[model samples]
Target: MAEQSLVFSFFLIFTGAAILATLALYTRQPLLVAYIVLGALLGPYGLSLVTDTALLADISHIGIIFLLFLLGLDMQPSHLLHMLKKATLVAIASSLIFMATGYGASLLFGFSQIEALIIGAALMFSSTIIGIKLLPTTVLHHRHTGELVVGLLLLQDVIAILVLLLLYSGNNEEQSGALAFLKTLAALPLMTAGAFLFVRYVLLRLLQSFDRFHEYIFLLALGWCLGMAELAQAIGLSAEMGAFVAGVTLATSPISQYIATSLKPLRDFFLILFFFSIGASFNLALVDAILVPSLVMTALVLALKPVVFRFLLIRISESKKLAWEIGFRLGQISEFSLLIAYLATSAALIGQEASHVIQATTILTFLFSSYLVIFNFPSPIAISDRLRKD
Candidate 1:
């Protein structure tokens, strides 16, 4: 197919997404799964209608940045820290188990040790998008369960940032990954200090002065989000993390809710592109090669994550019901998992075969896990009227 104009691309993508989404709703499937399937159907591996996937992937990442930002806007710094402390051991313990599971599965499939390690590292996270989006505010929000779910996810995000940092420094032959990790860790306090100072001095004043200008408020929020994202990247942290800090800094502002509410539509728009890019980038031809290993790993993730999480949470004195709920809610491979595959490939630490295995497994788990959650839980988009809480 010929390259399409930018306008035409948007037209085609959104239109296709809407049609597929309607079908998904009618069929009682998740809208996110529809987005992924649409991408697979229209992307280069399928029909090649949307061959320009690189740009779409880049745009889709902003959705994650904004998602974290909105998440920060809702969270209190002190509360986050307290929960992070409680969640630290759980995240670490669960990640090690998941990582080992992926490693064994990859090695069994004849991957090199390094490839298996990278794959294992990739498997250590769950999809924040799926976890957050499917949660019903009316039922889960403001509850201890909601706090636990959000805290665990945020803790996982921090771990992902460190993983990405290590991958990034792997690109620099002169720098050791451990040293880079320390530098990034040290810089975080400075960045946090700077963000708080800037927000207190400049951001608060602007919000107070222009409290009535809807347009100005919108522009300010967007600029602050992206600016913080850039700053985070500058300091070796992920843009998503930076955006989250930006939101956290403004969490105390009366206008923070307004900014969050306004930006959600924008966040949803970009997230669609993100999920689409996941599907578009997948190479269906590799399915035959990676099929067995991918399925095994997907099954491992689906089965192991819930059990481990539930056990750990229960051991920590959490109720079995809430423990099980959060466990199922987080039982999928994450977008960060895809990023690790891409980075490891870029760093020449893994081969195309290993990367494809990770991608395929992540997508498969995303589809199946989403269905499991919606079918079993109270979700905003659950098909069952009794389970739908939005």
Candidate 2:
């Protein structure tokens, strides 16, 4: 019966998603928003067709790992390093300004100091999925704007991982925060060394030997990605970071493009589940209580992020048009914000109200940002004929 229910739930989700996605395309709406709405309608808080969101969420997280892995595969090591170096100062400066904005706004809304701090931290990152999803692959993939956006997002991902580590450490009475920090610091070099050694000595040789077998190559790529992810988790680092490293190590391989192309549909499948899980997990009943503060914070994030990013990018010698485009492309709070809120609430570091506030704000930004990008820029689902690009 339990197995039957899980299968039934997936059937409903995919069926509903297809209908909604088609309607979204006809109506010139974002398909991501349609998936979220479908989840909200069918999930626990609504009609209750699917009640085990936690299980779905766990499965959906693999989507993020795959997303990061693909991102790494696309970037050559030298190009990635150059972009990171150029964007580091801009990323840091923009993050500090956004954090201060969030902190001040939360305090003004009567949140506790710790709650404000957590909220502020959550505001520091922009949505990687939305930013990359909306970008036209042909124009942005190798363009200057793409490089800057990717660089900043990568730095933010590192900061988010460290923040998560701190939250985890805080939950354990026996663990010293400094020790956790040092462990994470140490894990970077260790993971890099391990990835390179394995790729050079084992993975590349296997791929070379089995180059004729497409199916075998695909299995090997999945194995390599998941293996690194598990290894990273075994250490103090994040699985996403590890998956990225796995991809990076294989970036120079002749078969990297084949792997990337073959795995895209698989990646998209998991990502749909991920976006649905986001909507399914939220409880609308709690939103009313945090509505006022949440709206204020959301508005501030939507407005200030672009301005801050543009200013910083311009100051760092980026072109005005490029700066503005990158800024607007990143003008939304990240999915990591939702994760931070969940972790803080679970750890008893913040109240349910605060968590709800963060969730609501993140969703609001996701909705608006997607529309903004779709209407104004070149996207896969752009409303305008001229702006639509593959």
Which candidate tops TM-score? 2
Q: What is the lDDT of every predicted structure here?
A: 0.89, 0.88
Instruction: Estimate, for each residue in 215-283, the C-alpha lDDT of model 1 and write its tens digit.
Output: 999999999999999998987888888998999999989899899999999999999999999999999
TM-score of each: 0.96, 0.97
Give one digit per residue, the lDDT tens place, for model 2 in 1-390: 989998998998899999999999898899999989988999999899999999888888898888888877877888888999998998888888888988999899889999999999999999988888787656654366776788899899888988888888787755577788888888888898889998999999999999999999999999999999999988888788888899889999989989999988988888888888888988989877999998898889878888888888888898787787888899999989999999999899999988988998888899998988888777878999998886
Worst 10 residues of 2 by lDDT: 136-145
Q: How much lDDT does candidate 2 score? A: 0.88
Instruction: State in Å the error of residue 1, model 1.
Output: 14
